[model samples]
Target: MTKVINIQPVTRIEGHARIAIHLDDDGNVNDAFLHIMSLRGFEKFIEGRPAEEVPRIVNRICGICPWMHHLSSNKAVDGCFGVTPTPTGHKLRELCQTMAHINDKILHFFSLQLPISFSGRIVILRFGMSLESLKRRLNLQPRL
Candidate 1:
């Protein structure tokens, strides 16, 4: 006989998903796959869009797709219109985008580096292990 196993709303992701598994006659697992149920219509939302809205729309989508879609799209629109953004306008937008992306970079740095630092201290306290041993366990370096 065949069977269906369903898991709904899987965790640790931005959206909802479902996982399904199929089982064969002997009760051994046969196959499995994940399915995403949410669609934000991002493509449709962008079609026929005013160029000025690109930044705002892309900013809404996810973490970071186009870093400065608004400013970039505005520049493209300026090209299409055969005009230039004033030095002041361009610089201001650039500054704003740069600041936003920098903040994101700082957050990423902490997310990536802070845990490694703290984890080493934690391991040292708990197990009194050496860096070489930890590295070996993590497969980051060969055994000494």
Candidate 2:
């Protein structure tokens, strides 16, 4: 017999979602799927908006990766306007994007990867360290 296990409202995520894992007769994994249930309709919302304002509006689409959305929307607007950022501006944008990438990696590592990797065990720190303390111990300066 085959069975399907559904995990709904996946924890620690910003939106509603679920994962379905299928098992075959041998009880081994056979297939899986992820279902995302929320719809923001950003496209319909952004229609008829000024190009300059779209970037700001769309940035709210994803709380976890807002910078990526903002920067991408800015690029699209620039293309529509045939506007090329100066060399300095381009470098600054790239720097911010890189920083966002690093920030995301650090966040995911601590929030998602570490717990799973540790088999959901609570790793105690010597002095009841928090994430801030861990970052400080690692010599990571806050980006902004």
Candidate 3:
């Protein structure tokens, strides 16, 4: 007799996958298979949009890596049209991409640490509004 062990919907990562392990009569590890069960569908999503608009539109695919998708789509579209960026233009985009990667890393690091450190404590997120304003809004500061 043989049995299969299935692990579905993997976590701690962006996408989905399934892993299956099969056992032989002896119960030792027989074989394993990995099945990718998720797709981003950026192709179908971007098909009807104008090429010029793709850089901005493809950005909606993933919030964390939007800048990478934005720049890559733009470069691919340019190549499709037989256009090449100027040396300075290429350098600038590369610089901006490096900076975007750095920004994403810092934000993700803070987010992953927030729950462990803060627990249920007062917290304010979102862009704009100063720390003092957030403290006041959340009533964390002592009343005057």
Candidate 4:
């Protein structure tokens, strides 16, 4: 008989999601799926709002990637207004977006990937340890 394991409210990230692991009759893993259930009505919420304010309002779509939402909203508003950003302005926006990407990657590595990767091997420290100590324990070298 086939079986399924459902893990709900996946932590260490924004919004609600779940993971479904399907098992074969012999108990071997068959397939898996990730379901995201966070669909806020930003479209309706932003109706009739000023173009300049839309970016700020829509940035709340995802706490972890708010800059993405903000930048996308700005692009949409720019298209609607038929306006183009200056070269410097464009460069600044790209810099901010890149920084946001890096921030998200670091947060995910620390909060989600590390724990999942070392699920059974992670040691629980009664007293907190330094980042360098933790990296040494994990045998992870700093990457440039």
Number of colliding residue pairs in each model = 1, 0, 0, 0
> Model 3: per-residue lDDT, tens digit, 32-128?
9988887878888888788898998888877777889889998989988999999999999999899998988766654543422444343545568
- Pairs clashing within candidate 3: none
Report the error of model 4 at residue 24, Å: 8.2
lDDT of 4 at 29: 95
Local lDDT at 127 for model 2? 42
- List, residue by residue over 44-93, the lDDT tens digit for candidate 4: 98988998999999889888899999999899999999999999999999
User: For residue 112, what is the lDDT in candidate 3?
Assistant: 41
lDDT, candidate 1, 1-144, per-residue tens: 699898887743455799999999988899998998899887687888886666677666555434565566667678867998789987888898888798666554444433344453212222476867756544533223
TM-score of each: 0.46, 0.71, 0.60, 0.69
Candidate 2 matches the true fold with a TM-score of 0.71
Per-residue lDDT value at 62 in model 4 = 87
Question: Once superposed on the true structure, which residue ranges of model 3 sit more than 4 Å away at CA?
Answer: 86-88, 104-144
Which residue pairs in candidate 4 collide? none
lDDT of 1: 0.66
